[model samples]
Each structure stands twice: as C-alpha cells, then as structure tokens.
Target: MLIGDVARRSGVSARMLRHYESLGLVRPTGRSEAGYREYSSEDIRRIFHIESLRSLGLSLREVGLALDDPGFTPSGLVDDLIRQTRERIAAETELLTRLRRIDAAEPAGWEDVLRTVALLQALGSESAGKRQRAALSSAEEGPVPVEALAEAALSETDPNVAGALRWALARSGDTGLPLLAEGLGSPVAEVRRRAVQSIAEIPGGAATALLRQALTNSDVVVRRSAALALGTRGVANAVPTLIDMIVEGANDVDAADALSALASDPASTDQIATGLVGRLARGDVEASARRRLTQALADIPGTTTSRALADLSNDDDRAVALTATYLLTLRGAQ
Candidate 1:
C-alpha cells in the first residue's frame, strides 16, 4: 500500500508516516516505480502498536524500544504500571485515613500514615531520577484512607493511641467529625475534652451543635472543652453561650480562651465588652475572670471595646487595671 493508504488505515497522516520511518519506527517494504513508499502488513501492525502505546502515555523512545525488542514482554510493562497505580492508591488511602482519624471519636491509627509519608520522603531521597520523584510526589497528593484509620482508632482504648489518631485527623480537617463525636460521650473527661478540642478545630453547623451539647455536660472539663471548641470555631452563634460561661463559670484558662474566641471577631467584641462590663458591675465573676475578660475585650480594636477597656483600667483589681492599660497601649489609645 502507498503512504496515503497506510495513513488512511492507521489514522496517521502521510507526513507522520514518513517521519516515523525516519525515526526507524516504521519502514516501507518496497518503493513504487513512481518513487512513492509502499508499506507492508507488518509495517501497518507496528504503526497500530505505536498508536496504542502512545495512548497509554508511553513516549516515542520507549515505544520504539518495545517494538524493536522481539523478546519484549507486555506483561512486564503491565505489571509495572499496575504496581505504580497501586502505590498511588495506597498513598491516597493513607491520607484519607489520617483525615478520618482526626474526626473520629476514638483516636485514629496514624502510625501507618506517618510511616507511609516517611517512606515517600525516603524514596524521594533515594530516587534514581527525576521521573521517580515526580511519580512519588503525584502519589503523595492523592486522597487518603481516613475511614480505615478511624476504624482502627475506635478499636483502641488507650489515650495515647487516641491522641495520635486525633493529631492525624486534626491535620485533615472535618472528616473526623463522626469519630470525634463518639469521643464526646466517653466516660473519661480527658477523652471528652480531646474530642471536643478536635471538633472545635473543624467549625461547622454540625460541630456547633455538638459543642453546644457539650457546654451543658456534667463535667467542668467537658464544659471547658465546649467553650474552647466554640472559640476555635469562631462562630458568632457561640457568643451567647460563651458570655453566659464568662458571667457564671469559674475563672479558668478555658474561660479565658472562650472570651478570647468571642472577642476575636470585631462584630462580637461589643457584645462581649458589654457582657464583661456588666459582669464587673454586678461583681458576679471573680476579679481574675474580670481581668481575663478585660484583656480579651482589649484585644479587639475599634471604639466600643476600647471604651470598655478604659472603664476597667481604673478598676480596684490591679491585674484588671494593668490588662486594660496594656490593651489601651495596643489600641494606640494611651
């Protein structure tokens, strides 16, 4: 068949057929008297094979080697491709596992995920070439197996084990919610606190409800966790709850953190400042609590919080006065 006939049959153009010939990818069996190249059945087969391999992402050079080597085994190439694909899947599985673990009520099993990441890093260090590194990087960026890790975490009763899982899940964000929710009801206050803290990192409507429930929990630690969770979520919906805690709850780091969360937003600052001032006026909260709330309010900029801080700056409590002074300095109101 002529070059045009070969091109038509192979779906390649006549010009490409000549170029393939020049690259020794295909050769004509003979030439017509008119000087046109004539392809044989064998040349046509090679062209088809080249096209198939190219479609599979093989380069021309690799395709040429495969075609030239009579002993070339497609099975070997297929196995390598499968192995690479599996590695990519495994990497993705590992990432998702970490995410699920973070959201799990029980802790996630992050040892395997960490190990896999370490292995990838090591492979990168020992990579034979840039291509291997690129492949490894691509695999690393794939989805993780968070569900599996969450399941593994649920099987363990150890706090350390659970903490590790929580750490891994926290890195991935809200995927660990279901599992974390389970921990919220744990018998142990510490476990509940950890779970609440993990959920707080992931602010959502669902998480907000969970934290709200925790605020009314029997354990102070649990309640504290709820407050901190609300703070981390930074949702204005938590403002009323946090204010209530500040007015009625004992002076503690968690309460301080909750106040900070409330005042973190410019919009919430006024309400929080007003609440703090009210608490001070009523003498319902301790002097220490008042100081913490004053500082938290001062952390917020603008006129409302600033005026609130100025009132507290002359309070009988030295700490409250100092904190208010510090806030005034921060706001350039000194």
Candidate 2:
C-alpha cells in the first residue's frame, strides 16, 4: 500500500506516518514505481499499534520503547500509568469541587469570583490562623456555601479554627444541618464529635430535631454533646443522658445544671426528680455517684425530690447525709 493509502486506511495522517518513519517507528517495506514511500502490511500494522499505545497516555518515546525493546516489561510502566491517571483524576475532581463551591456562592463578577476562590484556598490552608481568619471572614463577606463551612467544621482539628468554623456555620443557620447530621454518622469518632458540636451551635427546630436524633447515636461523645445542647434548648428528652452523665462523672456538673434547667419547667420537675431518685435507688449507685445524685436534687422543687433528699439525709454514708442535710437547710430557708 502507498503512504497515502496507508494513511487513509489506518487513520494515521501522512505527516504522522512520516514522523514515525523518521523516528524509526515504522518504515515502508518496499519502494513503488514512482519512488513514493510504500508500506507493507506489517508496517501498517505497526502504525496502528503505535496509535493504540498513545491513546493510553504513553509518550512517543515510551511508545517507541514499548514497540522496540524486547527486554521492556509492561507491568511497571502500566502501574506508573495507573498512578498518573489517578493523580490526574484527583486533581480534576478537586478543581471541580472548588468550581462548584464558587458557583454556589453565586459570584456577581470577576471580583466576587476571585474573593470566593481566595476564601476557599484559605479555608484549606495548612496554617490554622489562615483557616480561622477565613472562617471568621466568611460570614462577613460574600456567602460561602454552607456545605463548605460544614465540611470544614467536621474536619477541622484545631480548636480555635474549629470554633470559628462552628460560629460561621451557626450564622448560616440550619442550612448546614443536614450535612452536619451526616457527619454524625461518620466512622471517625472525632468527626462524629465535631459534627454534634457544630450541630449544637446551630439554633432552630431542624437543628434541635437533629440533636434529638443524635441522642441515641452509638458514639458516647455524640450523645453527650447532643444532651448538653438539648438541655440548654429546654428539651426534656435529655434527662436520661444527663443523669447518666452524672453517674459516669462525664461532665456531671454540666449535666446537673441541665437537669436543673429542665426542672424549672413545672411539667418536667417531677420527671427530672424521678430520674434522679431512680438512680439513687439503684444498688449499683456508688457512694460518690449517690452523693452527686443527691446534690443534683437540691434545685429540684417537688415532694419527690424532698422525700429523696430527706431519705438521703439519714443515710449511713456521712458525705451523702451531710450533703443532703445542707441541701435541706437551704430548702427550708427557701
């Protein structure tokens, strides 16, 4: 076949075929009567092979080595190609994410686009200070997508930066609650903790509802954070977890305070007192935990708490008796 005919049939251009010949990749097996470059069937096949390899991201030099070097094994080269392709894909994916976030901001002009880009880069910066500043400024400037802020809040490890991210997310209202809710289910314990903490900062019925759902989360940290936040929000469902916190000595003081806050509501007063009294009645209630439970009852104003404290005042444990007596004195004074 003539060079033109070979080019037409193989889909390799004439210029490319000549270039391959110059590189000694392929050559015509024989000359035609007109002295035009002629290619045998074998030469045309080699041109097709080179194009096939190039499609796999092989450079011309690598393609030549692959075609000509008998000692070359494809395993290492193929692995390298796989790694390169993965890296390219990862870079493209990150770029796509950035573009999506920027578009979500709905930038009004070139200046807005540039500011959003800068804010995003700063949020991902290695310096905690830069991330903190970015988070603080996010609420003041053109809106950063709530998803971006929520993602940052979940992944942030630095306390200051995490606080700033949470504040920014809170200011965004419950827009990020769904994302944060998903974070509560993350396999990473720290991520689950952060997710609950961030959700606690967001104020609304949606956020409160999410915290209520998190009350049953398997992660202890998530449950505790949710309980504390719910307590402040005047949700009575946090009573059991708060009582458990007191027994376990995990933020027991805060849990007691939450119980007290709940007790302020006349409807919840007896429920809170009953939960505390029930823990006190348990055979497994340790002396210190029993006293803590007694102290927790001091602020609860009801006959149930009064009877429990009165019983505690006569207990054999000196610490429990004295603490209950002191509380009774205060109650009498009130």
What is the overall TM-score of model 2 with all chains considered together? 0.97
The lDDT leader among the candidates is 2
Please provide, for model 2 over 150-181, each residue's C-alpha lDDT reduced to its tens digit, 9 standing for 90 to 100: 99999999999999999999998888888898
CA lDDT of 176 in candidate 2?
Answer: 89
Measured by TM-score, the strongest candidate is 2
- Candidate 1: stretches off by over 4 Å: 1-148, 151-163, 171-176, 202-205, 240-264
Candidate 1 per-residue C-alpha lDDT over 266-294 given as tens digits, one digit per residue, 9 for 90 to 100: 77777766666676677567766666567
Clashes of 1: 19
Could you tell me which 10 consecutive residues in candidate 2 have the lowest summed lDDT? 141-150
- The all-Cα superposition gives candidate 1 an RMSD in Å to the true structure of 17.8
